[model samples]
Target chain A: MKVNELVQKLELEVLCEGESFFSDIDGCFAGDLLSLAMSNVRAGNVWITVQTNMNILGIASLTEASCTIVANGMNIPDAVIEKAKDENICLLRSEKGMYELCLSVGELI
Target chain B: MNSFKVQYTIDGEDFSVAGEASRKLKKVLQSLGVDPQIIRKATVAMYEGEINMVIHADGGVIDAEITPEKIHLFLRDKGPGIPDIALAMTEGFSTASDNVRELGFGAGMGLPNMEKYTDYMNIITEIGVGTTIEMIVNTSLS
Candidate 1:
């Protein structure tokens, strides 16, 4: 499924405007640890995490993940949003917790 | 085999730019038409090394050599070196402070994950001097 579809289905807030919203997502990986996420997440997967820092953007780009959904309505940093825009990474925010977000993403993909 | 080399200086104090080297290397590998799987492995391994340099080494130098057969990464850091290679290699063993942990890292999975993704890895370290890590990811599986 595409990132825009997931956003519509999950009712996630688009944090940054990017081309990846049309990118296809394979699955979902939920984790806060950067290394673990990088090591485990499959390319084209949607990363569900509570991490709001800029490193998440770096990881997203490195892993080539389709998008990042910050769970639990956390306030993503402005710098992170800007970087997301610059990198063309789809950044989204969700009111649901990690588990719910993962479930929704899993069902979609 | 044709070879290309690139070097990056990691700033230990800057968490924001920790994975820049790995990201750039990924692009280079992509442009060179390396296999995506091999590129992913190299990028992940190097990224973990880059993060380790920032979190533990207070900065370091990364030298990457890309060839037809493999991608080689040499990371050298001037920080408090690991006292026990075995212990440090163990998963879930971390010495990072609380502040570092707050950034969602320091789970002690960095080195282990790097080893997992790469075909070969080696670490040379001294107590107070520093640590140097060499990792290689083969482009083609044997």
Candidate 2:
């Protein structure tokens, strides 16, 4: 499914809609460990993590993930949000936990 | 053949800028027409090393030498060196504090991930003195 369609279907809160929001999403990979996620997540995968730090943005951009869903309603610092905008990374947030979001994203993509 | 070089001194106290060097290196590799997968492997490796510098070493200097055949990363730090390289190399081993964990790092995956993503990696460290790491990623110029 497309990034926008998946976001709509899952009812994700759009913290920032980057250019990739209009791109296609192929799979879902959920992990909070930056290094592992960096290694495992592929291009166009929607990464599910509770990490709201700046490194997540770097990982998201490096891996070129479709979008990163910060689950569990984690509070993302403004600095991180600004970094996301500057990098043009598609970052989303969800009230739901990682497991639930993964299921939803898995089904859609 | 002449190689492209990029260097950055990571601010050990700053979390936001830890991976800046890797990001720049990735862009340089991209502009030079490096392979996508090669770029991914090189950047990931470089980023992990860069973060490691900021976290464990209190910041360090990272130099990237980019050539058609490969990319070499040399990281140097004056932070307390590793006492047990073997234990540190094991997965799920980290000396980082609880604060670092909340940021989604310090899972003990950085070093292993560096080795995993690089073609060659070497470390020279002395406790209370400093540590230096060298990693290389082979690329396809053709």
Candidate 3:
């Protein structure tokens, strides 16, 4: 699935350039724990996390994650959005909780 | 075997800048044409270590040595050290305060996850002297 598809399916607000999600996504892993996500998620997997901290962006960049979906209607911090834009990483904000986002997107990818 | 080394001072002031060293190393490893899996493992493991140092120890020093067979990471911090290595290694046990947990870490999985993905790990510390962690990820599994 492409990141754009995830954006559409979840009805997420694209805080940054929505076109970047056109990149291919290989899998999906949803976790609030950054360490677990880093160890478990593949490079092109879309990471679904509830974290709004700046460190999350660094983790996403290091793992070369395809995109990040901040679940549970969390306010996407300006710093995080800025980092994502600079790194060309797709950042999406969803009002849906982690479980629902996973269930909805899991079936697709 | 050819050898390479890089040392970085993790800045204690900026939490957002914690993973700088690991990020740079990942790029270098990729440019050197290191195996993808090896690069991922090393980068993930080291990145976790770097974050741990910043969050728990108020930053520290990271020494990395790249060779034909493996990548070695030495992370040493001057902050208060762990009292019990065993308790700290448990998946859900954390010494991090509630404030740190709010930052999305302090989940008590740092050491365990570090050990899980690396080939070998050793943690040395004293009550007040600080902690020194050594982690090695083999490029080729034996």
Please report, in order, the local distance difference test score of every candidate based on alpha carbons. Answer: 0.89, 0.88, 0.85
Clashing pairs in 1: none
Ranking by DockQ: 1, 2, 3
lDDT of 1 at A64: 79
Interface root mean square deviation of every model, in Å? Answer: 0.7, 0.9, 1.0
Pairs of residues clashing in candidate 3? none
Candidate No. with top lDDT = 1
- TM-score of each model, in listed order: 0.97, 0.95, 0.93
Whichever of 1 and 3 has more DockQ, that candidate is 1
Clashing pairs in 2: none
Stretches of candidate 3 off by over 4 Å are A18-20
Number of the top TM-score candidate = 1
lDDT of 3 by residue, B1-142 (tens): 5788989899877888888888999988887778988998888888888888888888999999999988999999998999889989989998788888888788888888889879999999998889999999998855
Alpha-carbon shift of residue B24 in model 1 (angstroms): 0.6
lDDT digits (tens) for residues B78-116 of candidate 1: 899999999999999999999889999999998999999
TM-score of model 2 (first chain only)? 0.97
